[model samples]
Structures are given as C-alpha cells and as structure tokens.
Target: MSAVTPLLAAEELSFAYGPGQPVLREVSLAVAPGESLGLVGESGAGKTSLLRLLLGLSAPTGGRVVFEGHALDRRSAATMRKFRQAVQPVYQDPFSSLDPRMTVGESIAEPLRSLRVTGDRAARAARVAELLTAVDLPADAATRYPDAFSGGQRQRIAIARALAPKPRLILADEPLSALDTSVRMHVIELFQRLAREQGIGMLLVSHDLTIVSALCGRMAVLESGRIVEEGPTGQLLTEPQHPYTRRLLASVPRLPG
Candidate 1:
C-alpha cells in the first residue's frame, strides 16, 4: 500500500499501562492521504496515549493498528523500519527535542545522516539550511543553538527537523502548547500551511479546541478515554451533539458581546 492511500488506520483501539486501567477506550480513528485530524481532551483523557498507539509506538492493548493497510507486529524487522520511515512525530517542546550539545544545524540533518543519504557534508548542510528556510527561519539558524532562539523560533526549528524525513504523516503532541499565547497562533498557522501544502497528514493531540477548530477539518473530542463527539470541526463546535462535547465547546472563552 502506498503512503498516499488511506495510509494509516486504527480500529477499536484501547490501551493502558496496567490491567483494568485502560487509557484509551476503543478509540477508533484514521488518517488518509492529505488529511488532518485533531484529538482534543483534558489531561489524562488518553490523548497522548492515543497518539502513541496511532504512531505504532506502543502496542495496542486491544484492537489493531494498520499502517499502509498492513497490521503491525514489533518483531517484523523490515516492516517496522518501513513504518518508522513513513511516520514521524513532533514533540511539544522544541528545546527538549533537540540535543543541547548538538548545533541546530546538526539536529535537523541527523535524520538524513541516519538514513545514509550518501552525500558529502556540504550537501547535507545545504539541505538542512533549505529546510530551515521552509519553516520561515533564517539560514543562519543552522549555526545557532536551540537556546539562542525564542520559543516560537525553536518550534520552527523542530518543524524543520520533522520535515527532514519527508514522511507522510506527522503525529504532533501539543506542539504549540509551550509557546506564549501571542506566538501560539503563528505556530498553529504554520501547521495548517504544512498540512495543505505538503499534504502531510497530522494526528494533532491538543487540549486547545480553538486551535483545533481553526486548523482541523475534523476533530474528535475525548472524554473518559472514549471519543464522545467527532465530526467536521465546524459542525461539532457549533452544534455538538454529545453533552461532554457541548461542555467543551461552551468552555472555550468567547469574545465580549
């Protein structure tokens, strides 16, 4: 199956750290070619757990996870490597994601190096600089350290690093949650641009429904480990059918009358 196909799927997925302590309760979701789905919920509502399951990081305690229409088993050396190559994840904190000791340039280019991109060091550095520009950062950013950049700028660096692999799907966990409120909106917009322009399907796990509603075409609201409401973001937000979803929608701060 191709990455452009209904590339990733999870059916009735449930997981937990211990017996009788499920974190995800039969959470079913999918990401087809060029699609973005936002999963939103309060802390401990299994948002992060669900993201991990979708990315084939943790084995699903129940149900199955299918990538490129193939069910995953940890031991399949070839299949596991293929899955890893096709699916990449962007963490919430850029500073922590990068090795402080490594220069920003090195951090972004490491994936290519690991993949054995038979090129001279100069070629790799050029590629890294190109990616940095793609995320709206300066080429000089390649020489600087993550500590030298602001929170928003560091996230752009993280995004550049995530894009280095040219993966089909990116699982972003609260990617913009760490930035200041003023800078959060810009990062969210950058994600929207990447999803549409790159056709990079994203499983965005976040608690900010406002951001989800703005960037996502569809969203699932998790409550008590289950998806309480899901549909087109516009419809769900305006006319949520589930009580929990309604509560979530109502809780979003509204502008003054």
Candidate 2:
C-alpha cells in the first residue's frame, strides 16, 4: 500500500446471500487519491457484489470498507451524505441508468440538487453545461431526453452526471461494457482524460482486461469473489503469477504480428 491514505478501501470484505452461498470472501484493495485501480473478473465472480459493498448500497457480512481512513457508517446520514458527495458511481448499461423523462441537463444536475451542493438553479445550469462540454456533448443536448442519444452518447451523459458533484472518487462499474466496440476506445480515452485532468480517483470494475489495461495503473484480479492477484497494471499483464490472472490475460484478443 502507498504511504498516502487511500481514497477508498475494502479490507477483508466478505458477502453472501445465505448460509451456504458465499459471493465474496477476504477481499482487500485500495485506491489512493488521484489514482485509478481496476478490479477485473468474469461474470459471477462477485465483482458487482464488491462494488455494491464499496458504495454502501449493501452491508458486508464481514470486515469493512474504509474511506480516507474512516470506516463507512451508512446509518449516519450526515456521514453518508458526505461520503456520497465525495464518492460517486457510474454504472453499467447507460440505456437504463438514465431517466427517459428527464432532460439531459436535469439528469446531470440531479446530483448537485440531491447532494445539496452550494449552487442555485442558474449556477447548476452553468455547471451542467460545463460538464456536457467536458464530456464532449453539445451544450444544447441538455434539453433532449435520453431517447435522443445513442448508446455512446448516453454513456457520456452518464459520465457528465457522475462529474457534476466534483467527486473525489468515482466507483465505475463496467462503465464501457455497453458501448459499441468502435466507440469503446473513445470512451476509454475520455475516462483517462477525466482522471488525469480532474485528479479524481477511480475504482473501475470490469470483465475486460483490455479496458482495464488502458485506464488503470494498478489492478487487482478477482476470482470467485477473492483477490487472486494484484500489482502494477503492466507487471500483472506481462508476468501474471496467478493461474486465474494468466487465464484472464490469455483470453484478451490480440492482433497477430
């Protein structure tokens, strides 16, 4: 671990649906301020379960999630409100993540209102426009509904919404999985630029090693809800020590040279 305190961390975290059905066990990892960490695993590997735990959407059965050195206390509305402001989530499936009835601007400004950010209606509108530009969406697009946008555009809108709070950390769960292959790289670049320019920490959970390789400096390989391996992204990809990690890397499609 870095000497600097983590922006978010899962320590010996575990989860389950019932007595015999374990979803995750003994998982531990951290994302430092302005750093990006990737959690890669196959479906049913408990990746989403872990994300839920980190987001405080679900309580873990064992251990705890720490944010800036303090354990998360969901019952404390004041504390959780602060936590929500600092940490935001961008989920999978941009198609369903957004509300069809609300205009793009309203959706983006929702966080600002819900978080009680210090901004009036006009300020929020300006912030929304700024965010739309940051995400490469036209400012005028804000008046349109989700149905007017393509899958990639919707995802960009989702990203803008996540950024509205000026969050310190972003918990992105398979953020690019729903995009077209041709546009995936563009979104990947967008994520990289946002992380670099805004100094925001990210915990990206995905099944795609390629996406993780593109955005994450450090990565943790999760298998069956456990962290099988973790290290610098380059090192883990080139010299995977765990069989599961190696298998995952091997599965990535490569161009014949």
Candidate 3:
C-alpha cells in the first residue's frame, strides 16, 4: 500500500441491477497518486459496475467510494464538483463518448467550461491546443469532427479531453478494447507516459493482462463480481495464487512464431 493518501478507493463495495442479481460484492481497491492500478476480469465479472461505483456515477448498494480521504457525496453539489474536477474518465468507445455535433475543440473544452476551471476564452483555447499536441494530435484537429479521424486518433482525442482538466486520477474503462491490435500499443504507451512523466494516477480497467501489465505496477483480478487476487503486476501474473487468476492468464492470446 502507498504511504500517501489514495486518489480513489472503493471499500467493501457492492452493487446489483435487480433483486437477486448482484454484479459486485465486497470489492475493495485503491489507486494512489501517480500510480496505476489495473482491474482485470472476464466479461460479466462486474468490472464495469465496480468502475461506475468508483467514479461516483452510481451509488453502491453495500459500501462507499473515497477520494482524497473523503467519502464521495454525490448529493452535495460542492463535493461532486470537486470530485469531477479531480477525476476524469476515458470511456471505451471514443465515438460514443464524444459529441457528434461538437467540434473536437469544443468537446475538449466542455469539461473546462462545465467545471469552471480558471481560464478566459483565449487561455482555454491555448490549453486545448496544448492538450492536442500532448496527445500527438495536430492543432487543426480542434476544428474537425470525430468522423474525420481514425479510431486510434479519436481515442487520442478522447485522451486529450481527459487531460484537459489536469485531473489527479483517470478512470479508464477498457480504453484499448475498441482499437486495433496495432493501435493498442501506441495508446498503451500514452497511458504509461501519463504515469511516468505527467505524475497522474490511473485506474485502468481491462480484460487483457498483457496490455495492463505494460502500464500498471499493481493489478487486481475480479471474478464473478469479486476481487479474487491482487498484487504487483509481475508477481501476480507470473505466479497467480487464485485459480481464476491463473485461468485469466491462460486466456491471453500469444503471437505465432
């Protein structure tokens, strides 16, 4: 565990859709400042539900999420606003996450405008340009629509938007799942750079161990809506103690030599 306060944490968390259909149970995890924690699991394992709870998008039926030593209070406007400014999310589908009617610049600036981040119009526009450049997008990308770019480029734009707020933590839900194999590598590199150079913490949820391993130092495996195992990425992946963790590792695809 990190000595410093965690950026985000879920304590004894649980959730369900309808009666007798639980999605998560007693799940707990944390992302420390400048750290990356990968949550991995098979489909229907409740990874997304856990993520939603962590993000304060949905209230937990059992436990609570804590951010920066305070319990999340979605009902309090002040608390929610501060939380929104601190945590940014990168959804799996870049196409759907972005507005079709808005230009890329407008999309990136939306958080700044809505969050009331300190800046005049020109300052925000300059920040948008900086973010685009950081994400390896050209300045002209701001004027283009989402359809004007490839899937990889769109995800980069989404990343740029997420970084625009200078968030303390990033909640990424299968960010690379929607991209091609060739593109996933570059996107993963971008995430690593955020952790390494930018000093940002991330809660990256993915089913692929290899992808997460490339970026996260710690990892937790979810099975049947519960955390079955967790530890350093290399140790846990190489010597998985839980049967489910072992099974997940065995499922990863390898290249033909």
Candidate 4:
C-alpha cells in the first residue's frame, strides 16, 4: 500500500509578535488521516499561537505549514479556499462560537453556504437534520436558538457545525473546558466516536491530561512554545522524560496506593 499523506503538518514552525520574543520556536507536529493528537500545556505555553499557525490564520515568521503535501500559500485565494474547506475548527465556547440570532440549523448549514455546496433549500435542510441526528440532537433542536440548549447541547451543535464541512481534519481548541465537568467526558466520547466513525483526523488542544489521555492515542507536551516531549499517550503519562512533562503528569490526581 502507498504511504498515506499527512492531513496536516507544521514543519519546524516559528512565530513571533512585533519585536517580542518568539511565541513558538522550532515547534513541529503532524496529524495523519484518522489520527488524533492531544496538545497539552499550561497557559502562556503558546499552544494557541501554534494552533493559529497550523490553521493558517497567521503566517509564521519561519518554517511552514503543509496540508495534504502542499505548502499553505495564503497569497493564493484558491489555496486558502481549499485549505478552509479541508480544515475545520471547533472552539471552546460553544455559545460564543454560535451566532445568537441564527437558528441552530442555520448555524450548522452556514458552512455549506460558505463552501458553496450544491443543494436546494430542502436538500440543505435534510442535510442539517442528518447532521443533528449524527450528533444525537433531535431534529427539532435545529429550529431553536443557541440559548435554548444547555452548555453541553450547545457544544454538540458546535461539533455538528464542524462536521458540516466534511472536513478532513478537525482542530478543536479546549473543547471541554467550558462545559460542565460531568458533561466533559460525554463530549470527549462523542468526539472519539465521531472521528472514528467519520474517519477524520483530530488535533485536540487542552490542558486536562486525563481527558487527553482518554481521547487521544498520541500526545505532545508543549512548554514555552517548544515541544518538550511526545509519545504514545499511555507511555507519556506513565513515564514522561522532561521535567515539564513530569510536572504536568504530576498535577493529575490519582487514587491512593
């Protein structure tokens, strides 16, 4: 079998703002088809900055982002359009991520409109219903507004929206942080199921080690914009090498011996 090209990759990426010190220095990572990677770090570790660079929201001062073997060239509208179509993002705050005025169905279908997907009104509505069902939301939920649902339900809507584009890869930033602790695991499970069933790759960014360990097979630990350690989730959690990585693992509470 031929080697499967990576869905997304950041090669020796470096980014900085103004004249300040670089936020990300020589950082690199890759997300392959059907792969899920967890990006973990404390605040100010430059995780967000790195995500933006990967998403092509901002160009890096050095290095490059490659998607599907092609270097991202925002200068070309075609490159950007194709990149946007292939990559989707799910933000942490579902409520804010969703438009208040647009109905849930409209919000989910917005991507279809942006991508100029072909379909009549009825067909689009049917697609919206299908997506809602996929996320375990009732079809009628689509007629309601974002405020009509609980935090968890709103997040489900967000995930449905991310899935709308039929993206090759999903970049989720702190997806469960804004959710209730009880609902976090449920959402994480939903992510895993959706990614697996859809055969889509995921880059999940979060500080919760337990959640990452549960949801992702592989993980990368970031400290001050650099990847300090990376490996299979199980090995990294049990036997981390870097002091920063060990400290992160230490923060996770454990049962009495």
Query: Residue 94 in model 3: shift from native, Å?
Result: 1.6
Q: What is the TM-score ranking, best to worst?
A: 2, 3, 4, 1
Stronger candidate by TM-score (1 vs 3)? 3
Candidate 1 regions with alpha-carbon error over 4 angstroms? 1-5, 117-120
Q: Model 4 compared with the native: what TM-score?
A: 0.96
lDDT of 1 by residue, 118-171 (tens): 257988888898898789898888888889999898888888887886888888
Clashing pairs in 4: none
lDDT of 3: 0.90
Clashing pairs in 3: none
In order, candidate lDDTs are 0.84, 0.93, 0.90, 0.90
Residue range with the least summed lDDT across 10 consecutive positions in model 1: 111-120
Candidate that would win on lDDT: 2
Name model 3 segments beyond 4 Å from true: none
Roughly what TM-score does model 1 have, to 2 decimal places?
0.93
lDDT of 2 by residue, 1-257 (tens): 74899889999999999999999998999899998999999999999999999999999999999988999999999889899999999999999999999999999999999989846999999999999999899989989999999999999999999899899999999999888998898898899899888988899999988888899999999999899999999999999999999899888888999
Candidate 3 is scored at a TM of 0.97
Which candidate's TM-score is highest? 2
